[model samples]
Target: MEQAELPSPPSPARLPWDFHPALTEERLRLCGRMLANARRDALAMARYEMGDDPWSVGCRAFAFGRNRLQRAASSGDYPWLEVLDDSAHFVFVIGGNGNGVPVRFYRGAADEPTERTLRRQEMEVQQLSLALGETEAEGLAFRLAVET
Candidate 1:
């Protein structure tokens, strides 16, 4: 009997926010630890805030985003940065591994005002940046940080 062929891997999903160039090896390690330590606490906080209503769906979304970012940073395959706007919504700039493509990440709500969402968005961005070693203040922003 012939052996079966293995399935191909899925393509990486693109984020909806922009990225800067603050990603560094040292920062990635630091952020990884921080995210690893705080993930459970963060989830708990989300559950508390959203309760068991449909709004709780947002918490799951946040977790999905957070987990993706954490895994990408930990793998060192991609470099990224996170920024916080005045309202506190996060804007993430994710780059391709070795390639120079870029993608963004953020949350959206049609009914809510932007200001009300800033805090959570900003917190998410801050944690992601810390994990990737990138910061808005550094001004090392990049649409893509392709590894040569």
Candidate 2:
């Protein structure tokens, strides 16, 4: 008797959403919107800085957890969602000093975040806070021991 040949595994889908290119386009639009908003704020700040006017430099931070459910809809890296959901939380800490005191701000996600993702987000927050020169300390923080 001749041995039968087994079928090969199916190829992974290229798009994360059912809508194919539409999802990619949507995400790109979101990125563009964010950039445009940033640019507008930057221009306003530049105008304020030109006249030697005192500007409020403060950090605003926000963090949210992403679960497998959310990950299933994301078009980005799969490993990020997997690791973040499985084993590590992402914490963003932003520190800056303006008038005299050192200010610290923070944001955190309950779900696990990959080291690379966490680092990238952390750096972004840090740079933003530093640029502002004032930090608003708020949000989640990791505690080794809970004090009653």
Candidate 3:
């Protein structure tokens, strides 16, 4: 199905964000749907440690924008979106893997990661910054950290 494209959102940099430790199943289902039909939405997710710590955490964030039915065939950015459960603290969206749509959210403060799992991610962010210049980089939707 061809899902509608969501409207634009605020610059991720301007918003105050924090690390989201975990996402619950109930919340995921509720918010995942919310994102699909939202007027404005941009979200990010990541996996890494918090500066010299053993705690590996998953992160998700929702910017001010909108999302509809995004699928691999329909949208390269967010494929197989099942549900978006949005809440005060976090917004949960599910993306299908071979097993199911794994729910993740983008929340608070995250240092540019040094973890090797996302080694390329940091490099890409740098390249984007260099290519677009700092101000322009902030405008691009893809500038937000995207995790799968």
Candidate 4:
């Protein structure tokens, strides 16, 4: 009789974003739409600062685990999405909303945002919260204990 080999375990990095329990398609779609709104709003802000159309300006948004330093297993199943401006001056986190329909927001990004940048990001978050039919405080907290 021939011996059979066991299948190797899945790579940590190969895991899909939807592997997170709360990362539903609906939520991801909502996040993307909200990020687009944020980007469009930022274009106006950028125009206000630079006095131009900012037609070429853009931003990037993506999903990531709660704790970037830790393995996915240790990071829990909640998903966090980030939207960062092209200038790298502004960024914000759309935290897990749990059973709620509104998305949450938090400070910080790949590049450290300055006080002025953070204040601008806060204004966007406040607007987003109101648009989502929830108060900023209601969607303010992170879902998992893991720090981002």
* TM-score to native of every candidate shown: 0.31, 0.21, 0.21, 0.27
Q: What ranges in model 4 sit over 4 Å off?
A: 1-18, 48-148
List RMSD in Å for every model shown: 13.8, 19.1, 17.9, 14.8
Better of 2 and 4 by lDDT: 4
Question: In model 1, which runs have C-alpha deviations exceeding 4 angstroms?
Answer: 1-52, 81-106, 109-113, 119-148
| Candidate 1 residue-wise lDDT, 1-148, digit = tens | 9999989999775332324344444544544444444444445556554455435644555455456555555565544433222221323433333322122333443234244333334344444455355544232222222111
Error of 1 at 61 (Å): 1.4
* Comparison by lDDT, 1 against 3, better one: 1
Clashes of 4: 0
Best by lDDT: 1
Q: Across residues 79-144, which tens digit of lDDT does each residue of candidate 4 receive?
A: 444432222333333344422222233334624544443344454445345434354344332221
Per-candidate clashes come to: 16, 3, 25, 0
- The predicted structure with the larger lDDT, 2 or 3, is 3
What is the alpha-carbon lDDT for the whole of candidate 4?
0.37
Whole-model lDDT for model 1 versus the true structure?
Answer: 0.40
